[model samples]
Target: MKGSDPKPQSYEQLPLQFQLYDCSAGQSDCSQCRAVPEEYGCVWCSGTCVYNQSCTSVPADTCPPPQITQVSERCSVLSSSQMTCPTPAVTPEVKVKGVWFQLDNVRVHYETIKGKSFTYYPNPEFFPLNREAPDAPYRFKPGGVIAVEGQHLTRAISRQEVKARLGDRECEVKTLDNTHLYCEPPEIQPLSVDDRSELPCLKVFMGNLEVELGRVQYDSDSLSVVPLAAQISLAAGAAVIILSVLVVILMYRRKSKQALRDYKKVLLQLETLEINVGDQCRKEFTVASFPPF
Candidate 1:
């Protein structure tokens, strides 16, 4: 009862006989689709068909380009130039002292090892006893200055441009220039008091980039200082060994003397018992001798 001639279908259908037109063919006036210029975009409209869409077109300059006023920091275009193009890219190389070098190849001349000392042994080379005051602190010290070489280091105009690091720790840059950079090594906390790990090589940095100047190692002949505590421990160990030996010897001598005393006491008891038995035997044999006398 509710069925009305099942409402006529409303699905989209294409005409059986139709010709396809190239929308991008740039046809200005065509029977199928005509391209028309608009203020914002080029549009194609079909008067006969319901199909219509935006069309691509080469924009014609109705007015001249904007005038160049202030100079751009990157590119400076000349007034006579027709086409506006970008400026050339920045080169990676920098010039210094007539020599050209890649920014990464910049070298920092610095003396890495001012002095080094061992935790136990002290060497005059690392800590010259003659050069230091008589009351100078123990040979083992924490930090020292790193003297940079090269005259070009002075070229760095500001401290912000130059930076330095030792291993993962950033060091304080004292003096910096094109030729030299003076820096104090970071105060590193070793895992243990006897830590003898090699000092990390000094890294000279320019802003965020790391400079590849090769690794710097400490001179092996430098002063090698040892901790005073380690020396004292060695002396204490020797004293303990000597004391143990003396104690063992004294104990052995004491045992020997006690054994000699015991042996002498046993001999004396035996002699006394023998004398008492002789007296008792004489008493027993001399019975009833009064009558005979």
Candidate 2:
């Protein structure tokens, strides 16, 4: 990195000076050169005192913290209490009963085969995952950010290393963390019945490794979006049904208890009347005994 004919004279051209090192200006200090923070895309060459950076090998052993170089939409991450939600970090996880599964996070009811597992190796590299949720199908907004999650990923891999595609449309993907990659999908074309082309593939590639996440199914028909009012009405209907069932059960129990109480009261009255009749018979029998005496 050191040569006499170095870079521009912009206070950056200086040679490494030692005890006997003397420049044309008889200077032996390199402090002024080391303070420049690479402001002009070039910093002080490590071993040399010149600012026209000639150090080609960057020390990979030490790395600075990562920073977001683009704008991002916000996402909530499940974290311990008091931790804040990360901005634009979106890798959804699935919760089943008391256990958590590292599967596609689609908000819908589904049943999976217990203890099922499968493996995939990236073929020529790219696997983009698409999960279908039940209820009313939500249409994808073109240019909206979509999150793809993977296991055992690391920050060492840069966003440039991964490539994502929806069908043939290239999705600009950005890595947010070890587990999530965000992509902006292009406008999608719905499939038609007459379309004989193979279903469009959603894949992410890392060099030559490719994982087949799934296939996209487009249709000429569109799903009807359920409005907020209809959803509220459905919830109210369910509540009404549950309340009616509880009321009927309470009424049945009350009727049974009333009948039991009435039967017990009648039995007590009949016992009292039988005792009175026995007393009257005893009085008549006593009179006959007196005449014999």
Which number leads on lDDT? 2
Please give, for residues 256-286, the per-residue lDDT of candidate 2 as tens digits: 8998999888888888888988898899889
Lowest summed lDDT over 10 consecutive residues: which window, candidate 2? 20-29
Best by TM-score: 2
What is the lDDT for 205 in model 2? 66
Q: Which whole-number lDDT from 0 to 100 does residue 2 have in model 1?
A: 85
- Candidate 1 regions exceeding 4 Å error are 1-89, 92-144, 151-156, 186-199, 220-293
Q: Rate the local accuracy (lDDT) of all candidates.
A: 0.48, 0.52
Each prediction's total of clashing residue pairs, residues at least 3 apart in sequence or on different chains, is 22, 15
Angstrom error of the Cα, residue 61, model 2: value is: 46
